[model samples]
Target: MSAPDAGGESTRDREPVLRVRGLRKAYGERLVLDDVDLDVHAGDVVCLIGSSGSGKSTLLRCLDLLEPVDDGTIHLDGVEITDPAVDERAVRRRIGMVFQAYNLFPHLTVLENCTLAPRHAHGVRRREARDRALGLLERFGLAGHADQHPDRLSGGQQQRAAVVRALCTRPELLLLDEITAALDPELVGEVLDIVRDLAAGGTTMVLATHEMSFAREVATTVCFLEGGRILEQGPPARMFSDPTHERTRSFLKRVLAP
Candidate 1:
């Protein structure tokens, strides 16, 4: 499939890796996501940027089927994943999610944590899973710490391991929800660097982030969400330098302020 152009419009006749339409989610009286629409083509690194409570994280969760939407449809690779008969576990196998918190098993070593999902959930062979886990760990500079528990690693190391764990599944698409939110200021760069590498390697990813500068640098497309809607979306260059929406401009002003 051909990649979308800089305007976020497809350049060829190909289905997006992930497609969302008229999505709505709410918590009783509070409407969190309202009629959201998104399309992520293969190899697209789409960034969702907004302040707290802007529904960025919720949208990612909904995409992963961790939270059921009150309305709308989600399609992965042209299949309707939100269908009632679709097996969520099967869908999740093709989509990897890394959360803000490391969420590593306290009792498991880093290698064990990385191999667990692939081996158990996806039914990959134990030895194969182990080999893949070790390879990813080595690639991410975590091989030396593979035998250690999560608590023993620094915040940056733990998050890197978390990313490695997600990659171990060999997912077709990755969803990251503020993966650097829990890290110390200095540690953010290390985790973001892994994402940069992944982007360069053509990984299809959708991420909710506050790291505006990193998003501008790494994202093929940047989306600004406000009040549970995407106010503006375009190439990172245009979205960062010249947003078309007033709300988006105001947001960029505050976040980009020195």
Candidate 2:
């Protein structure tokens, strides 16, 4: 599939917070992402929709520098992050990622989990990290559970703590990989609510989600992927109601079937 124009005319003049071009990734002989291109401006909520194994999660991992790409150029704030000389650790400090599983340290308290990266990786003072962690926990309604371990909290609460942990770093970009995929149906809303609040507050985010209705409501831009490529992309209104590609239309029809 031909790559769609990145960000359309609305974002033409402004530099994107995240920019990707000619991105490709492969595992052995199987290519997971093929010539993918994307742009995410500051405060933009970009949703990636695709079938399993269509490379959504791998794409997120590449953006976070967790996976080394085979070929591509990825720029964060105009800096070429794909460069071999770039500091992966420093780049990671600017990008926060939350996985499907909470991935919270089992033995640590929620507050400890939230403060670890800041205190150790970012060199935040212990006291300041504690203050920032508590503040974010309070904002997300997880403050009261600060001392609890991951086992002591519900799935939703644990996920919220995970998000709060990411936010405590004040990352310029946030990547969420199927965050709701691990939650019970009844518990999904709580985690999505936190994401909604973040969107409202203008946090820059790129999320791969199966929650079609939520993506329609929350995404500034949506990209539909099939067979490891972005086949269509546009504002949610158009992408949802009228996609340019037949593959995208068919995929949406199947997923949004009533």
Candidate 3:
């Protein structure tokens, strides 16, 4: 993990879009992730599920190099980038992430917030960025509110805007860490509706979430993690219907229980 070449040398024929091996993270003496491994293919939606504090968010952050790893390596399409010293800006530019808290700037209009990143990150002109933002907003039915501030929009609308902001980066990988956790149950469906469309479009996505129903339907693979370790992973039907690990079965029972 210390050296740039320390990552697993075993790569597939097509090469995964994002790969992580033996990933570990610690905050002081508290271990957040322990010996984790994952891969996201070109057109796959892999959903990582676990109880709260199971290292889902930490794993996502580590993939994007937002949080430095204590041990392990990450690669994007066979390109090693999570070595001891990685290009942080370049890595972030290739990975688009949406967090639970929208994190929109209240002072800036929705249009500005969505377009600013593209303008600064890629040197896109103001007019071009504005046009791009408008196009993305219209995809989620938010074109009419482009001029409004964050506070003026509903929770669902704000979350959709955050998704558009991340899309404006034109990233190859999209990481969503429980983006609907803070919204009302009714509002949650609206935001998820947009995500559903993206999944249908065969976007490469890695989602850490509690939306079992949505994950079951849209994800090509589902992984159940417990205590920072992936207990089981397989096709959604095999995972939900025929889980082999006791922890996975228990977790599903609890999640599926009324």
Candidate 2 structure quality by residue, lDDT tens digits, 55-154: 9999999999999999989999999999999999999999999999989999899999999999999999999999999999999999899999989999
Q: What is the C-alpha lDDT profile of model 3 across 200-222, one tens digit per residue?
A: 88889999999999889998888
Ranking by TM-score: 2, 1, 3
Q: Find the candidate with the highest TM-score and give its number.
A: 2
After aligning candidate 3 to the native by TM-score, how far in Å is the CA of 232 from where it should be?
1.1
Question: Which one wins by lDDT: 2 or 3?
Answer: 2
Best by lDDT: 2
Off by over 4 Å in 2: 5-8
TM-score of 2: 0.97
List per-prediction Cα lDDT, in the order shown. Answer: 0.92, 0.93, 0.87
Q: TM-scores for all candidates?
A: 0.96, 0.97, 0.94
Instruction: Return the candidate ranking by lDDT, descending.
Output: 2, 1, 3
Q: lDDT at 14 for candidate 3?
A: 83
Question: In model 3, how large is the Cα lDDT of residue 52?
Answer: 96
lDDT at residue 58 of model 1 (Cα atoms)? 97
